[model samples]
Target: MRKEHEEFVDSFEGQLPPSIIAEIKDTCPASVTKEQLKEIVELTLGLYKHCRVNAGECVGLVSAESIGEPGTQMTLNTFHFAGVSEMNVTTGLPRIIEIFDAQKEIKTPMMEIYMKPSHNDLEKVKKFAIKIKEVVFGDFGAEYVLNIFEQSMTIKLNKALLSERGLSSKDLAAAVKVKSKGFNMEVGNDFLTFVHKGKPEEIRQLYDLREKMRPVKIDGLKGITQVLPVKRGDEYIILTLGTNLEAIFEYPEVDISRTMSNDIHEVYNVLGIEAARQAVINEVFKVIESQGLNIDIRHIMLVSDIMCITGAVKGITRYGVVSEKASVLARASFETPIKHLISAALESETDRLTSVVENVMINQPVPLGTGLPGLITKLK
Candidate 1:
C-alpha cells in the first residue's frame, strides 16, 4: 500500500509539467510540495464522492414521490407491427370492447385472429361481425348485440370504462410512458395508444371517442419520475409521471417529491457525463481554494477521477491511498490537529490582549501584569 501510494504521488507529480509548477511556485511564493499536492488531490476526490452519492439518493427519492402521488395516468399510443399494413386501427377503450363482443360467440372466447392486408381491415371485420349476427338471429338481433358492445365502451360515473377496460387518464394521478418491445409509441405530447383488439365497429367507436376528448395538455411538465425500490421481483415500480402543472398543483406531494426524483433521473439521463465531469472540477477547485493551497488543475482532475469514478458519494477512507497520503502529509507539515487548535487559541488570546489595551487607554490598570511592577524584590 505504501509503495502504491508513492507511485501514485510520483505519477501525479510527473504529470504536472515543470513550467506550470514553477510558475505556480513563483506566483504563490510557497512552492508546491509533493505533500501539499497530494492533499489537494485527496480533498478533491472526497468532494466528488460526496456529490455522486447524494445525487443518486436525490434521484431515487424524487422518483418515489412522483409515482406515489394521486391523479396520475399512463397513455400507450401504438402503431402497426412490421410486415403488416392497411389494417391499421387506433387503440381505445371502445375498440377493445368491440373485439371482446365479437369473440364472445366463439367457444374459446380467447381466440387470436390474424389480419392480413384485406383481412386486417377494421371496417371489413365490423361488417363481417354484423353479417354473422344477422345470420344467427336476424337484423334486429344483430343490432341489439352490436349496441351492447357499443354501450360497454361508455365511460362510467366512476371514470372507468364500462366495457373492455384499461386505465384512464383520470384514474391515475400521473402517467409514465415506458419504452416497450417492437414498434412501441415514443413519449410524446399526446395520449398513449395501444393496438386495436376488437371488431371494426367497436374500434371505430373508441377511436372516435379518443379523438373527441381533447388531448390532456401537460403544461410545464419538467420530466418523468421513476422509482425502483431495492427489492426482489417487481414489488414497487412507479414508472412514469405526467408533466401536467395543474395536476401537480392539485397534488403537490407528487410534484415536489416524485416528479422531482424523475426530473433528477432525467438530468442523469440527459447530462450524466457532463455533470460528473463538472462535479469533479468544482470539488477540486473548492478544496484548493478553501485550504489556501496551490496545486495544478490537472492534479485536481486526477483527484476528481479517484473520488467520482464510481459515481457514488463517499467520505475520505483509509483504503484509498489518496486520502491517507494527503492526511499524513497535512499532519506532518501542520502537526496533525494542532495547528487549527493553536490558531483558535491564538484568536482567543488576541481578543484578551485587545481588551487589556482598551482598559489601559481608559487609564485603568491592565489585568495581571499590567497593574504590577515587573521588578519586585521580596525582603526575605
Candidate 2:
C-alpha cells in the first residue's frame, strides 16, 4: 500500500481495541484481502462525505415538512452543526416539489436554502452552528457528527477571509443568522450585529437530539466466492450455480436414468434433492477424473443441479423459459463447499461435453428456455 493509504488504515485500525481486532481476526480468519481493505476504506470515506452533505438536509426536511403551510411557498436555509458543520435547509414550493419527485429515484430529498453572510460575524455564526450540532447529535450518541460541523466552519472561514474589502468580517458573521425567527445576540460591539434573523438554537438543538442513530456497520457482502474456470473445447466458462447443462456431456448418449432416484419438486423433499444432487455431482467428477481433467471440486458443485435433473437450471436464463424450481434447487444445493463440490462437477461436464461433443447435455437451454424474450407459444 502507498504511505498515505497505509497511514489511513493504521489510523482507522487504531479506533478499535486490541481485543476487538483479535476477535475479528479469529472469527473472520484473515479474510480481509488487500482489495477488500481498499473497498472498506473507500466505502467509509464515501459514507463520511454523504453524511456531511445530508445530515443538515435531514433536519431541513423535518422542519419544512412540519411548519410550512400545506400549499405555501417557503425557502429556509441555515448552517447545521453536529460536531461537523453543514449548509442545509429547504427551498420554495416548486423546488420542494422537485425534491419530492427526485427522492423516488435518487433516495435523497433536498432543496436549496439561501444564506448571505456578512464579513466578521461569519466565523462566530459558524462556530455557533458547530456547537449546536454537537450538542444535538451528541445527545443521540453520535460522537462523529461534530466532524462535519467543524469542516463547514472551516469552509465559511476561508470564504470570509478571501472576500472583497467592503464586506467586514463582523458583517459576515452577523449575516449567518436568519432574521424571521427574531433571534439576535451580541458577541462584541464591533463584531456582533444582526445581518439576518437565524433559527433558534433550541430548535436546532431539538432537531439534532432527535436525529437517527448512526449505524455501527454497513450492509453488503462480507466476501465473494472466487471465480472458478472450466475449459470447454477452445473456450472457458465461469462455473456458477446458474451454469447450463448442455455444457456437461462430452458425447451423444441415450436419455439415461437420473443419477438421483427421488422426487425433488416439493420443498419438503430436501433429502431427495440433496441425495440426487450429490450423486449427479459425484458422477460428473468421476467423468472428469476419467478424462484426467484437473479442476476444482467447488466449481463442479456450483452447477450440480442442472446436470442431475431433467429440469432446466433455475436462474440460468436462456431465451424463453425460466427454470423456477431448478434455479431454486441449484441455489440451495451449493450454499457451502460441499454443494460447491457438486456445482464444480456439473461445470466440468458442461465444458467437456459442449466442447468435445457439440451437443446440448442434460438441462442446457434452447430457444424454448425460460429466459426467452416476448411471448412463447407452442403451435398445435
Candidate 3:
C-alpha cells in the first residue's frame, strides 16, 4: 500500500505473509510515522520467527507428547455447582478428552448464550434466562401423586413458582393438554390432574407415563436446565449447564453470532468443521489455562489440526484417526500389532513405508528433512 509500509515489509526478506503485512498496513493510521511502522514491523516479524519451528521438528509427535505430559497433571474430577444449583458438568481431563474425541453425547453439555444488545438489560436477561431454563412438572409441582383407583396422576403446583414464572395453572394445563390429549385434564389454582383413558389395571403403563412426564419441557429451551448470568469485562453473558444449540438460536433476542455450544459435534452440525477445529483449540487451551499451566499454543494448534484434518472430528484412538492411517504398518505400530497386520494381510494391503512410523518400523531412516536427501556427493 504505502511506500513506508511496503519498504518496512521488504525488510523482512519475504518471510512474513502478504496477508499479515496488508492487515498491519490497513490498521495503521494514514499519518503514522515511518519510525512507528518500522518498530511494529520488526516486532511482528521477530514474534513470527520465534514461533516458527525447524524443518525436521516432527511436530505431530512433539505435540502429542507435549499435550499428554501436561494432561497427566490435570485433575480427573468433574465440577458440580455447590448444592443449590443441583447440576453437574464434566470438566477437567475428562472434558478435554471428550472434546478431542468429538464424542456425540457429551457428559455435561453446556452453552454460552449472548443476548442481543437491546435485550441485555438485567431484567430482560433474567426473564429470558428463566424462559429458556428447562421446566419440568416435577420442578414446579409441590407433590406428585398416583391415583390407581381413578387411573389418574395429579401434581400440586407451587403457587409462588407459578407466579414467579408468570404462569397460571390454566397455562400449565393447556401445555400438557397440547402434548398429551389422551388424558382427561382438569386445571385449578396450584393443582392439575390427568386421568388416562387407559384402564386403571394397566398399572405399568401409568408408571411409564409418570417417568416420561418428569422431563416434559413445559416452556423453555430444551436441555437447558440452569442459567447463570455473568459479567464479563463490560458485558453480561449467560452460562448454561445444558446444551441445545439448535433450539436456543430460535429465540429472536439471542446474539446468534456470539452464542456458542460447548458440545463439539453440535458446533460442527450448526457451524461446520472449521468451527469445530477452533472449538477444540479453544477448549484445550481453556482447560490448561484454568489450571494455571502454560503449554506452547503451537502444540495445541497441531493437535487441533490433526483431529480436524479428516473434515470431521475424530478421536486420537484406535477406532478413530490411528486406524485410518494410510500406512498399514503405521496402524499396526499404534497398537494391537497382530490384528492390524493380519487384517492388512487378508486384504493384500501394502505398506509403502512413506510415513515416519512405517519407515522406522522397517529400520529405515525416517524421511524428514535431511532424511529426504537420497544422494550424497563428494565436495571435491
Candidate 4:
C-alpha cells in the first residue's frame, strides 16, 4: 500500500480491527484523494460499529433461533443419489443432524481429490482414479469351483480384469496364500488351485476360505470403494465414495492443499481443529444453501466458533459442547434434567444463577439486555 494510505488506515487501527482497516486500504482505489479515502474508511468503520452486537445481547439464543427455525423446514430425504450408478450421499435434515451430533460414522463419507496441475490430464486422472479405488479378489475373479471330492478349491481369474487393474495371476495367488492360511496354493496361467491342508473331515474350511479370500484388497488404498474422474471447469478432479484423508495425502500426485473430505472427524484428525471448524461451516452452509434457506452466515460462524473454542471439534449435543457449561441448570435444561440435578446434588454444587436458563427457572430476569445492570441504592 502507499504511505498515505497506510497512514490513513493506521488512524482507524484502534477504532476498528487491523484486518478490517487493511481490507479497506487494499480495496480503496488509488485514484481517490486522501480525503476520499478518509471518507471511505470512516464509512466502513461506521458500518462495522453498526453491525457489531450490543454488549448485553443474547447472541447464543439468537443464533439458536436463527439456525433452528429454518432447520425444521429442511427436507427429510436421506440419500439423494444423482444417478443410478452414482454414489449415495446423505443430504438435507439427516446430514445436518449428523453434523450437529458429530456422529463418528457418517452415512456416506465422500472426498474430492484434486490432482497437481501437471498430473490432471484426462488419461492420467482416469488412471489415478482407477488406481485409488479399492480392488478386491472378487472384482477380478472370473470363476470359483469347489471340489468336495478332492477337498480343493480352484479359482479362475479374468485376465482382462487383472491386466486392467495392473495385476498378474501371481499377485492373486500371493494374496490368497497370505489370507487363506493352512492352504497349499498353486498358480497357473490365469488361475489358482488351493488344496486344503487341514483334516479331510474339516472340508467346510475350504469353502469358508474361498468366500473370505474374495474381498481381500489386492490393489489401491483401503476404504476407497469407488472413484470417478470428472472435468471440473478447466481442471480434472476425482470424486470418491469413501474418505481416507491421511492415506490419500501420501500420494505425490494429489493436490493435498485443495483436496476436501465430507467427514469432519477425518478432517480434524488430518488437518487439525481449525480446518475441521471451517469444514463444519462449509458443510452446514452447503446444506442450508441447497435447501434454499436464507439464514445469515454469522450465525453458522458463531456455532462453529463455539464448537471449536475448546481446541477441539465438538457437537452441539449434551455430551459435546453443552457438557462443558459451567452452570448446572443450563446443562440440566438441555437434556436428562434429573441426571444432571442428581450429579450436581452429589457433588454439592451451587447454582449462582448467572445465566439465562437457570434464572428463568426461578422466575427471575435473565442477566442480559435491560437486566444486565444492577440498581444501586443510596441510604440517607
RMSD of each: 25.8, 30.9, 4.9, 3.2
Q: Candidate 4, 293: how far from true, in Å?
A: 1.4
- Candidate 2, residues 72-121, lDDT tens digits: the string is 42333333323333322223343333222222221112211112223114
Poorest lDDT segment (10 consecutive residues) of candidate 1: 134-143
What are the clash counts of all predictions, listed in order? 26, 64, 0, 0
Question: Among these predicted structures, which one has the highest TM-score?
Answer: 4
Ranking by TM-score: 4, 3, 1, 2
Q: Which digits, one per residue and each the tens of the lDDT, describe model 3 over residues 128-201?
A: 88888888866777887888788887889988878878888888776666665667777778788878765556
Per-model C-alpha lDDT, please?
A: 0.33, 0.32, 0.81, 0.88
lDDT score, candidate 1, position 274: 46
What is the model-wide C-alpha lDDT for candidate 2? 0.32
lDDT of model 3 at position 324: 81
- The residue-by-residue lDDT of candidate 1 on 214-306, one tens digit each, is 233222233222111121142221222222222333432222322221121222343464454454455335433443444455544554354
Clashes of 4: 0
Question: Residue 342 deviation, candidate 1, in Å?
Answer: 69
Deviation (Å) of 264 in candidate 1: 8.5
- Scanning candidate 2 in windows of ten residues, the lowest lDDT window is 216-225
